[model samples]
Target: MTPPHPLAPAAPPVVPHVEVPTPRVPPPSSLSLPTPRRRGRGDDALPRPQSVVPGALAALAVSGACLALTLTAPAAPALLVAIVLGVVARAAHAVPASFERGLAWVGRRVLRTGVVLLGLQLSARDVLALGPPELGVLVVTVATTFSATLWLGRRLRVGRSLTLLVATGFSICGAAAVAAMSPVADAEDDDVATAVALVTLYGSVAILVVPVVARAARLSDRTAGLWAGMSVHEVAQVVAAAGAVSAAALSVAVVAKLARVVLLAPLVTAVGVVRRRGGARSGGAAVPVVPLFVIGFLVAVAVRTVGGVPDVAVPVVHGATTLALGAAMVGLGTQVHVARLARSGGRAVLLGAVATTVAMTVSLGGLLAVGALG
Candidate 1:
């Protein structure tokens, strides 16, 4: 068919004007792509600020709710209640990320403030009443218990921070002591909660068990009170435990408990010293010889000693202290992760038990040795 067009029309033979588009490839010079950031030495310094509201609000709400619960059940201190609520709420995953900043503020700032006010509860007059022998025994008990628990904790493979917290709480005034030391030791919220839980459980049991033992032993009211005060974890628990023995016992119990509380400053100082030494050896940033919070606590005690805070205003100050501490507890509690705590296993509990046992045995022996147990 194309034979006639071989010369003239061969080029256009049966060809149709059809267009097929090819995929476009842009020139390299015109393309713009993002280059990933190269991480460097400033990685650990000056952490970027993040949104911190949701967690903070959740913590504050938890604190308020728990504080209300304590009102209904006076046996349950609001501080302890806050910790439990925090753990439960956190495990439910109800805490939102937005509250992170608020929670951080609540945990660190409120905690330090509570420790400062804790000092107003003490006075130089009460310190004098404790006497040298009683003070010596109390100090020895705390020192021994703290050291022994740390050793036991390591052997049991408990986390280091948890071990320190449990030892402090048990050897001193339970949850209050734990909270005071949490910041000094740089402890996490869950660790503090776990330690607080341990101290509260033992302290509660002591309230019931100690009085029965005192009665069975036919101990004098003074002796019974001294025993309760030395061994019990909380001041309220101490009163309840000793009061069950006799009215006189309650008065003595309060005195003995205060002696323990006064020692908190020294204990915190000792811990800071140890940590500082360790940090120095490891070449970490210089750790302070004394924590700023401890200084504030001591100042509060000194002011009270001189009656810088008037008698008429004492109750108001006490109420404020409770509220501040209660809020801090609530803040600390919300950071707890119950499942993670459980996974940490039995060592923490065992460490707490060892501390309790040592504290009771040593303090009781001291009271008897000094003829203070009557």
Candidate 2:
């Protein structure tokens, strides 16, 4: 507002006072947050030979031993035998830290590859051939078992992480489900260990129990196999359980189990959403909408369904699947620390038992209803 001399330069215009936000510098801890180890799909680095060879060799040795044992005792499933030896070794501290990386690699990568190959054995047409009723049974069984396990876990006061892990494992694909769910759920290592142990214990027992129950119930081999596939925790467990009945049953069982395996991606995504909404932090890498291997599985299924695979390749693929899966089972077996599991708490064990029963009961009941409806 002051008058200025004509010789003076014109005054600059007054600028409005605008508050600029100071860029927030995160604390050092936040800036350098350590990434949690990812066991879920898409974390596929090949470990160093020094880190991988020892455990891989050990797993191969156990797989060979299991195979030899199965020849002498046809009733014993090689997969079951492999897991048992792994559990025994783990309980005895026979597995060293050196074997950890290799075993983890085999358990995740090799196991997933086997699962992908497993799809070659299935025909989507065959699955659809079951019509809506049988398919409905599979869906109902998975949902009911998952819900029942969650309910029982709450009633038993088990930790939410453990409960979620166990529920995912039992209602889906056993140890694989536990592995997939851990990161999304922000589960602790101890919770993971306990969940894996429970799934291993009950899933192993299921290998024996399911066949016996199927026999006692006088179910047809197909029906029995379907029940096993629907109810059993792991792919290996389902194979062992259904195989104990007959070759035909084993075929049916694998197809049925794969159907349930297909549900894993969506389920994991849904759980991740629920956790995020509940203000839970992810413990590891972001959850993949669909794991790479699961996509591979679907591709394989499509190939087989379309008759793109030659007949000569069938048995070779089957043999490879068996070998890869069998080796992975050895790694799974070693994760079971019986002593640690026992010391953890009885409530977890009880929850596992209830979950197992719920899976079996719901699957069998659904199968029966399907039969009636058919």
Candidate 3:
């Protein structure tokens, strides 16, 4: 009907569909997947060099400081300084874990190395020179004092391990005696540490006080030396106490103390045997074996007597060993907190004081009775 409108009538022709390309998505990259780096045998084999250097430097510093103080304070006693340093280290937690681990390693593995070095300082012949009478006196005094201390420790409620350590240390040698008995007694680190501190403290006091008392009493050098060696808790203390009396006294005291140290193994073994029997009945692990360091110390003394070590090397090695021990002592001291010492330790200290007094009285009386002072 409207055929009239040619332009409108024509209408638009239908358009054909055309295909268009869609954006391509790239496949996930290999790097994008999580991959754990494998550790080669070689990679894990070596210790990180950087981590060890600091610990080495710290140990060296501690050792150097200890030596410097010893040199500078010849009159004041170096052990005191070492103890103080150890306490400080403990308080500040300044010692690195690596250094602590190293010290422990040395203490357990290379302890004999220290003992061997210490041997250059003594001889069996020197020990034997004291003769049977003096030896008898020394032996009886050590045994009696040790037994009395242990008895008192039990009565006083001191821990069993601590009591053993204190008794052995007091009766036989000082630090060496404690070290020998520590494992056998199943002493914790803290127990050994506390015992060491007590020994060190009292030893220092004896070193300073005994000579003054001896001088005032007008005792002979040999008498004073015997008294100091028998009463003091440490070899260093005996030496220091006797030296304050006189050089002659120092010589006597050191020899006497060394002789006492030689008795450590038998004494500890006896204690261990007793402990093992008791533990067996109680259904506990057997007592630990006596430490080899004590044997090493005895061997070193024998070797020195037999002329095994060189003279110059002796002093050098001795100095190094002493420094290491001092450092370790400092570490031990630092582990104790004053608060803890005050809280749980007061009773132990009291027990130690009583034991020390008993030891001193018994020793002095025995010495006088035997005419050892003359």
lDDT: which candidate is best? Answer: 2
Score every model by TM-score: 0.81, 0.70, 0.77
Residue 67 displacement (Å), model 3: 2.7
The sequence of per-residue lDDT tens digits that candidate 2 reaches over residues 161-251 is 8889899989988766776666566665557657766776888898889888888988989899898898998776788889999998898
Number of the candidate with higher lDDT, 2 or 3: 2
Candidate 3: tens digits of C-alpha lDDT, residues 1-374: 55556555676789998898998766655556766544322211223445445543454466568777777876544444665666677677776776654444333333234444565567677778686767777888888888888888888888888888888877876665676776677765567677777787677777777888888888889878988887888776787788888899888888788787777777877877787777632114467455556667667777888888767776676677676666555544545576766675877887778767776777777777778454
What would the TM-score be for candidate 3 when compared with the true structure? 0.77
* Alpha-carbon RMSD of each model: 8.9, 10.5, 11.4
Q: Which 10-residue window of candidate 2 scores lowest in summed lDDT?
A: 35-44
Over 4 Å off, model 1: 1-61, 280-284, 372-374
Model 1 reaches what TM-score against the true structure? 0.81
Q: How many backbone clashes does candidate 3 have?
A: 3
Model 2 residue 96 lDDT?
91
The Cα error of candidate 1 at residue 132, in Å, is 2.6
Question: Candidate 3: deviation at residue 245, Å?
Answer: 1.8
Q: State which candidate, 1 or 2, has the greater lDDT.
A: 2
Which ten contiguous residues of candidate 1 have the minimum total lDDT? 39-48
| Model 2: how far residue 297 lies from native, Å | 3.2
Which whole-number lDDT from 0 to 100 does residue 250 have in model 2? 93
lDDT of 1 by residue, 20-86 (tens): 8998877765557655444322211222234435555566666666667766886887777877776
